[model samples]
Target chain A: MGDPGRDEPLAELADDLRRMVVETLCHAQAGHPGGSLSAAEILAALFFSVMRIDPRHPDWEARDRFILSKGHAAPVYYAALARRGFFPEEMLQTYDELDSLLQGHPDMRCPGVDMTSGSLGQGLSVGLGMALGLRLKAIDARVFVVLGDGELQEGQVWEAAMAAPKFGLDSLVAIIDDNQIQLMGDTATIMPVEPIAEKWLAFNWNVLEVDGHDPAAIVAACAAAQAVRGRPTVILAHTVKGKGVSFMENTHKWHSALVTEDLKEKALTELCVREVR
Target chain B: MVEMVAMRDAYGQALVDLGDRDARVVAVDADLASSSKMDLFAEAFPERFFQIGIAEANMTGIAAGLAVMGFIPFTSTFASFATCRAADQIRVSIAQPNLTVVIGGAYGGVLAGKTGKSHQAIEDMAIMRAMPNMTVLAPGDGVEVRKAVFAVADHDGPVYLRMSRDPSPVVFDDSCEFKIGRAVLVREGRDVTVITTGIMLGRAVEAAELLAARGISVHLLHVHTVKPLDVAAVAAAAEKTGLVVTAEEHNIIGGLGGAVAEALGEHRPTPMKRVGVADVYSESAPNDDLLQKYGLTAGHIAQAARSLMERRAAHAQP
Candidate 1:
């Protein structure tokens, strides 16, 4: 299982995801572009290569669970879910529209969404519950929860952090998208969650750091997490706020922005150029 | 004809029974294990029990996590801390997803004498009832509490069980059955109805006996589950008596009074009076004195019933 050569091709999947994010946000005309783009690679790797889930049976009892804790980045999760065949790819256009299953936030009512998680700092707790639930039932399924760097500011997250190791929830893994930018401004300026790895380690979690763009490294961290016992794992994936798009990258303004015709064209061109590589 | 038992002791005994039968049944407490009777569970199954040091929010969140993992978690803490401190977590984490997390709010209402207003949870029912997918129960006595413990454990989803601190007299016999969303008529009468819940039910029974001597027949309805309130029974009692009196050892603004009013207002609009603490913070006093001062005793309920009867009689005249 540790054979690095066995890893699937993630670049192609990331390219497809980049295209989906651009197309969905363009079609919907609304979404959090910066955060969604920043976390695209991590989402791609989890859905395509790591998580053990069946697209055909969304509620499979033994299937692994994934929670998008930073629900603002739902466009990325929706794109991955659609590509995995959880729903019709056409539903991507309905993002944030009234009565549409696809809202700005991830809703559990949607087929592949494990929990409703637009509210920050809550998805971790929900994921922890699912992990504990699996342990009690003697199920082998693991729980993977994605958290934004900004979401770590909430006190509830720390509260949950203290409990994970104490309960010996080794089946749980939290991946933080450390983009260094929040809604207000740079995360360091708004509320510094500096020394991210140290904080999780202090809380007794087995912390792993990786480059957000490197799918191989992300998969390796997940594997390392699975190898451990007793303590839960936290993979601190360092990322740029908006990775693919030149204009949006590292800009907090794009954390959530309208997709104008010009902006959409520029984003699509950048993604298309990357897919060609 | 219903026998009574304290809900707190029943909760402890039921937890021990659940732990014995199912390994997935885990008990988590915020340092009130002895008072809530969770000591029996802890001693019986050390591995399954967790003492989560005075952190109510963390306890609730952890229980939510345990439930999601397929563990049946019963979280015990003082009523005020359980409901007020961790309300947001309860609403979002547990109730929202409809997890099987049983919250035992021991020492509910004025029963926590000497501890005063800070410890007493007068608004727990109101706070929990507001959330969707939550089942709220306040058992009448020790026997009903035990039955309620077993019943809630068997049921799925989120449940808030409010229990008393002090030991109340056993009012229910072993033969008396308990079911969620059902009300039991402790004593039947037609002249007036006294609908009560929790420890206050005992006082309401006493009030009924006293009213019988005064030639005013009193009907006693013990409402165990407060949220899915036995509306039909309350409506039936109201239709028969044309007068209703609600009693509870909680704030008059919510709790039993609010539930009874909400039910009766929709179905049978009868002349009603509520016997509970009148929206004021309680001062430190002995448990009995506190109950009497807060208008939560038999005499207060009887007086409220009499007033409702008087109002009904006035309306009956041409």
Candidate 2:
């Protein structure tokens, strides 16, 4: 409806994020790769095309807020923030280092981070608070929260899901990274969260299932979320666990494994090939 | 003995006042609205109040959402559920982001009486105090509770306001002003300094008066706000009298006693005695009987103070 072609810049942004994620993980030598790589496209689209935010003024009163509920995917978020000029891109290398602002998880102490998150199932609630706070202040800023599919096992997430619509937090958007693999193993083998979209709808949210890798579809779904007026929106993004990396893709082992030099090079080559195409 | 008022009642009255002053202030309760005395707020501002059912975690998460949206949300429930059931959410979701969420944990310690240990929140102070950027307040009475509520509203960041479910006597009058991180010296003495918080402050006040009649002048410092502790006041009181006695209605391990010891251990080391529930689950009994059984009464505090004085005298003689 709005502009189907608005997704043109998203693909480039996602590619850029993938490269950044790989580079940062290589530099940090200790970070989550699988989930971060899986979430790059979604983060890129949300930051570059979907959300209305100002990089210069990270705490702008009227700016939209994004909460990475699955905080282990900090690499992608840090990449997007650095790219957006929220901080120096060079600082991305110091992620998880002592006294580094780029913490292993998103810390609110860092600029551009609306709420400190990483402990799963909690971010949506905090994002809900921010969205509600904006509405109470009569500020027209929307809140977008990204949650992991595996993290849904946390009972608190369901609690937040039930509450969002009750408050009429229409400005709140929850994006679930429905990556099949979790930390232990396949999510189905560990704890199944199938029928995800139906669950969200049951909780009174406006549910939309989309191809997470398809930047165009994500942008469109996000636009639909913005257009909705009463209930909160949930985008059940169907994504691969280790999206970009050839060896890492669709594997739970890479969820948070250290990226060896060989693995890094291989991952970079795969991302580059994806970029060139 | 001085009259006392329960801090929970003050919280309810303050909620009503806050709702009247600011429309953005809302109360969310998980089926404890009436018990927490939030019915008045709900009755007055039906539109602003939210009955969140029996979901403590959900209530906390929703409150975080409400706070983020620029509304001051006060979530009420039993201390056990408020802290234990939703501790992670409170820590990461609210405190980490530094949202303006006030968690009113009623029925802390043996205040739940017949409900027994399952409902008691002996570990709440420890859990909340461990959190970063959290303001932990344990107001002494109704007047102090009002001050603490207002103080929390003014102070930015997350706050855990521990209140009592039982009806406590009114200690402070309307003239009392609550200041964050400042310990109020209710009863001043010279022999020993007694630092007390929560409902136990009333007991400490009575103990201090009793000690005064027996020529033992005991200084009573009511520490309403636990975290962002009144270090200077506590240190100053400890400095004046080398003997210190800390009293609270919680476990001695991580509650007010432990907090005081930790502070005094770093600042000015003094011979101290802690008056609180020892490490043991409370059994079913009447409120007064439970207080006596758990060593949370005025008599227990006075006895602990006397023993500390004796120990101080013995150390001085040697």
| CA deviation > 4 Å runs, candidate 1 | A1-8, A97-103, B1-5, B313-318
Q: Name model 2 segments beyond 4 Å from true.
A: A1-8, A227-229, B1-4, B312-318
Residue A116 error, candidate 2, Å: 1.4
For DockQ, the strongest prediction is: 2
lDDT of 2 by residue, A130-166 (tens): 7766766789878999999999998878888887888
lDDT of 1 by residue, B1-318 (tens): 544455667778888987788777888888899989999999999877877676787788778877866688899899889999989879877887788899989989877858878998888888999899999999888888878878877898999999998778777788998999999988888899888888888888889888999999988888998988999998998887888898888888867789889888888888889888899888778977887788788999889888877776787799
* lDDT: worst 10-residue window of model 1 chain B: B1-10
Error (Å) of candidate 1 at residue B300 is 1.4
Assess every candidate by TM-score.
Answer: 0.92, 0.93
RMSD to native, candidate 2: 3.0
* Interface DockQ of each model: 0.48, 0.60
**Top candidate when judged by TM-score against the true structure:** 2
* Model 2, position A114: C-alpha lDDT score: 77
